[model samples]
Target: MRLFIAEKPSLGRAIAEVLPKPLKKGEGFVTAANGDTVSWCIGHLLELQAPEAYNPAFKKWSHEHLPIIPEKWLLTPKRNTSKQLGVLRSLVKQASSLVHAGDPDREGQLLVDELINFLGVKGDKKAAVQRCLINDLNPAAVSQAVANLRRNQDFIPLSTSALARSRADWLYGINLTRAYTLQGQQVGYKGVLSVGRVQTPVLGLVVRRDLAIAAFVSHPFYEVWAQLATATGERFKAKWQPSAACQPYLDEQGRNLSRALADNVARRISGQTGTVSRLQREHKKQSAALPYSLSTLQIDASKAFGLSAQQTLDICQELYEKYQLITYPRSDCRFLPTEHHSQAATVVAAIEHNLGQLNGQAIATLPLNLQQKSRAWNDTKVSAHHAIIPTLKRHSGLSKAQGQVYGLVSRNYLIQFMAPYEFASTEVEVSIAAGSFIAKAIEPKVEGWKQLFPKRSAKAGDPAEDADQLLPNLTKGQLLSSLQADLLEKATSAPKPYSDATLLAAMTGIGAHVSDPAVRKILKDTDGLGTEATRAGIIELLFKRGFLLRQGKSIVATDTGRIFITALPDVATTPDMTAQWEAQLTAIAEGRGQYQALMDPLTEQLQAMTLASRSVVPTQLKGLGTAKVFGKKKRARKKTSA
Candidate 1:
């Protein structure tokens, strides 16, 4: 009998429902009409055993067991999941063929691969292995996945990549956590001290930002603003010319030269006709944003709905796993390949039916543009699923917040296929007594995808107005009969605090400082620091560890976070470290790099880091109730005779 292994119970049940008749469900296996037995794993039924699991002596935490480097890592069934493993093991023993139906991602691949390895299945002598690749849990997708099953060997590289990452994280987490916790206890602290590869770097980002804020010395600077009236009696604000060069006159020595400067410039051309020195205009079109990947969705939700990253992820997960109205939601790729176009249309149709009259018209007008593709959007790069898009099932009974998030994902999917927003821009240059000033305007000819979202009020000095412009009748040398002007002073402002939206963007390493075109391209391709599935968890972990605290939308580092970052060596606290590791891992996946070659250095580096951290002392808290210093402190001296 053929044995089928699915990633989870829910997915397995879904697949079983779609199989041919004569399928019968058993303890943990379902028998197909052809005598194939299908079973599923509960995520990861087995994991790398902890250090203490290897030897009884290692059970007690101590600094003496500083770097517990295992010569050969061993896997054992997780206690809670042993029963599920037992069922699978029994089926494997009787089966002549095997099919892997894990989630179509690295972690998913590793889950089944590890189970098979632990069960002592090897080579062709073991049941012939095939992989079921389904992006959605619907019956049609499931049938297609089973019909087009791939050889297991085709995904060995992917599974290897996943295994390498898992083992590396395990080694780092176990060794560092034990070493740090034991050291803390030795210093008289009782709290659990934890460290992780992703969590540590994320914590470092918050701490670094906090340090920058603390070290910032505010500098006062000024700008001169003047209000001017055109011949048509329209008022607008104009700034002094040579804005950057005039800084000295405005801010130097705190000297006031307002009257002197105004008089000197006012006499130059008070009555002279302002010339349109430059009248450059161009028509531009911007395509709609690609569909939602988990990270992208989290970013937009945080920006548009004020939801935290974790909150957004939780909502998406619920929508995908429970509601079943969306595909796997934790993907990074944004584009669906041509093969998926037909299925995508079905999903859109379902969305139209669900929206009723609210957004039915907009949904009905979606144009399929699968032929055009962006470098950022592609099929080959898709790991787990083809970005998060609405499922072929009509959604209902959603909470208000779920509806809002669903709207975002659905709209993004439809908009990506629509035409780009087209607009015409106009620029007018005017020369006044003060200096040459430029006025710009825009006229949007087609709303296109922007129509999907509600229009918002334009902010002051916004450049969006330049997108759609129809200038009033005017010539190069138009003279003005009368003019009015007002001068106002504005102060330079400090950098703004990080909102959840901005923090996610920063953590993803998409900052303005990433100026190189190639590096920026790489960052875009890689989806920044961590995978979408993992980024929110990393943020949540930071919060749980007392490394960061959220103040409304802003994230602030705790004192402990700052001290921890400062205590660690510089290598532990930078995005570059992750980027470097990713580069090597990618190379390994592409067959250009070896797994052991990459891991050997990492293992050594971790060991060195553990040793170095041992010599460093942890900081202590004082004078706080029940928060005593970790290390011994000098007692207060008794009163001395005078």
Candidate 2:
């Protein structure tokens, strides 16, 4: 019997549908017509063994054991999942051949791979394991993936990376959480000061932002503005163009920032006729943006539909699995595989058909613009999965959320074929005796992809101060009779709180925050704290753990969260630590490093960190804490006791 194990139930069924006909369904697995078995794990059928599993003494929290490092790893079958696990074990016993049909990513590979290893932990050598990486559940993609299966051993490095990450997370979380929980308990605070590799860094992000927003003081500034009319009575608005020598008024970046300077300039320019000193015109074109990576999709969904990251992920998953309208949703890459261009026409046709039924006038009329090869089609840029795009299967009856997300994916794909947005830009520099002012206008030549998402009004998606305005043709020597100037007072505003849109963006390119150039480059090459597949869940976990609160659409750290960061060691505070570890994970995946490479440094860091933490005085969590033992006991032994 040949056995196939999937990471999830849906994938198992999908695999079953493609293998053979007359499949027999069992309680936990399916028997294909060819006598092969297709089974699935409901996520992981096992979890890491708790501290108590190693030794009974270690179970009890104590300062005596600062850093808990398990010499031998362990796994216990998860509660409520034993039934399916038993079925897998039974299938494993009789199977002459095995297939690991897990998800294409490291986590998925590790889940089934670990299960097979655990089954053999009792010295039962099994058949050679083959890996099946199925990106799409469609019959063609599934068939191709199954036919091109690689030996399971080929993915050992990937599984190694995953295991290293899991172990390090355990080492960091278990040791630090227990250490801090004990410390906080000594300080009279009661709670599990839970810490995690990804969770801590994410919480630190929100905490840092909350602090910055709180500390920010708004400063008043001003800019001089003028409304000018051409000889033909054509009107336009201009702003005082700060010169290179513009003192105190100019910022380090040469931005106008002084109110007094601005007021003087405005007062001097008032009622004075000024000629157009320079009229610069240029024709420019902007290509359409690439399709959605999970991060970009989440950002757009948050900004346009006000959907949370989790909500967007859920919606996109359904769109991919249930409706079959989209491809994989948890992709990190915004670029399509270079070879996928061959399937572009079919996908476009499917999209047009589907949109024709929904709203033909708006979406169906989209031109077939998939021919242009943009930077977003590079094979080198494609990662585990390509960008989220419409699939060839375009069935209807999707939920409202599905429709909104699908439309975004389809529009992005279709726009690649359309012409680039073309415009003619004109800048008029008007010079008076006191200062120079500038007026700018952009005349649209071709809407390109923007035609699909037309602006509703003149100030669409723009601030009023920098809104697009129409400009009349004017010569360099032309003078305006109607000249008026005004001083506009603006405040240097505080940094806005992070919305879901902004937070996801921050998490995606988090490597940018690193001061160390070498480390930052490594971080840049990888996702920051969590995988794209897991970031949404991490954020949700933070909320459940009382680390964050949602204020409207903005996410803010709670008081407990803030205190936790202050109370925790530096190891648990910054994104850089997580980023550095992720860089190692990346290395492991690329076969450049080994599991011990990560575990060694991780273990050493934990040991040194825990011992150092033991010496420091924990900050009292006032009001939330009671007066209690804040230090290692200082009581002298009674002489009579001996």
Candidate 3:
């Protein structure tokens, strides 16, 4: 018999629907008419064995066992899914041919492959196993994937990379957590001081920001503005641009720090005639942002609906798996596969159908040019999955949250088929008595895709102060009269606390926060601190561990969180180490790096860190108080028939 081992049951069902008819369903599998069986794992059927599995003494957390490195790694069946493992083992023994159907990413590759290896599928049997990558659960997409199976052996590098990352996380988190918890215990703290490779650095970011905010001092700055009238009787205001002579009176940021200098500039510019030294006008066009990657989607959802990152991911998962409204949700790629261009009309139709009467207007009435291909269509930029987009399946009766998220995805996709937003800009520089005053304005030429979005309210300190203003036509060398002059006093504001939206944006663009150029480049290329699939979970985990708290819309570090970060070594608190590890992991996935090449150095580092962890002063952990315990809520069991 030929068998297909899928990553999850929904996927197995997706595959089964495309096979021969007369399907027979079993407890944990489905058999097609052609004698092809499909079985699935409930996530991972196996996980890395605990330290106690390596040695009995390792179970006790003590200073003597600080750096517990296993000579050989081992895997054991997960207790919750052991029954599914047995079911698959029986099917593996009966099947003559195997197809590995897993999600099209690193973790997905390892979960199913590890099961195959644990089931003792080796020698010729393993060599012949086929690999199927499914990023879309639509029957048409799944059918195409099934017919184009590749050799599972071709993905060994990917699986190896995932294994290396898993082991690395295990070693780093397990050892550091134990060591820190021991240190905290010695300091009379009653809770576990958990630490993670990614989680610690993230917590460190919040703590440092809080400290900076508290220590920041506000200072007053001065600016001089002159009200001018054009020859055509048009009035406008232009701020004075300090000349080189004022350098001695300015601050490091070039702000006018002297009220006397500001007063002199305002007085000189008042009731004076000036020539228009420069007049500049230009036309500009901007395309709509590309479709949503998981991180981008999370950031937008947080900003628009106040949804947390995890909540957005959960809603997207349902939209992908249960409702079949969208493609894979955990994608890091924002570009679409070129082949997907052909399906644009179908996807648009589905979106129209799903959105009918939901919005007051008919979606079909919108000028959606199906033939307009934007830069978003690029095969080279697509990763394991394309952008999160609506599929050609229409349904209604979605919850309000689902509708909100789905609308966002659909609008982004539809706008790609529209023209770029176009505008005309004007800038005028007036010269009067040793001071330069400038005014700028922007005029909308075409609304284009921007019409689909609602108008945003003006925010404080918006950089585009003249975005909505229109300047009067004025030519160079034209004389204008200064009507009035004013000196404005402003105080520099402290950095605002991170809102959910800004925090996710920070996490995605963390490279800007790092000082080292090499590490910054690596992080920028690697898409920051964590993968799209895990970033939401990492942020949520920080909150669960009492390291982060929410005040209104802002996320702040708790007292315990601040102390924990302050107590850690710089290596543990910074993003540099994690960025390097990610770059190495990428190399491993591309067949350019070896697992041992990365792990060997990490082991040595851990040994040093573990020894140094012992010297952490117990007083540093004082006043942390008792930590809150978080556990999974158990599901109520279904009563079985006797």
- RMSD of each candidate? 7.7, 7.0, 3.8
Span of 10 residues, lowest total lDDT, candidate 2: 633-642
TM-score of each: 0.86, 0.90, 0.96
What tens-digit string does per-residue lDDT give for candidate 2 at 230-264? 66788788888787678666665466777778877
Model 1 is weakest, by summed lDDT over 10 consecutive residues, at 633-642
What is the model-wide C-alpha lDDT for candidate 3?
A: 0.86
Models sorted by lDDT, best on top: 3, 2, 1
Instruction: List candidate 1 segments past 4 Å from native.
Output: 125-127, 186-188, 224-273, 357-384, 431-436, 460-488, 510-525, 621-642
Candidate 2 lDDT at 447 equals 81
Give lDDT tens digits, candidate 3, residues 1-642. 999999889899999999999999999999999999999998878878889999899888997897889898999987888899999999999999999998888888998899999999999999999999888889999999999999999999999988898899889988999998989988887678888888899888888899999999989989887788986789877878988989998888899989998888888889999889999999999998899998999898888899998899989989988988999888888999899999998999899888863235467777778999999999998866788898988898999899989988988898999889999988889998868998888788998888778766655673324355567888899999997787888888788888777888888898988999999999988868878888888887788778899999989999889888888999999899999988899999989999998899999999999999999975756766565443443321111000
Full-model lDDT, candidate 1: 0.69
> Considering summed lDDT, which 10 consecutive residues are worst modelled in model 3?
633-642
Taking all chains together, the TM-score of candidate 2 against the true structure is 0.90
Q: On TM-score, who's better, 2 or 3?
A: 3
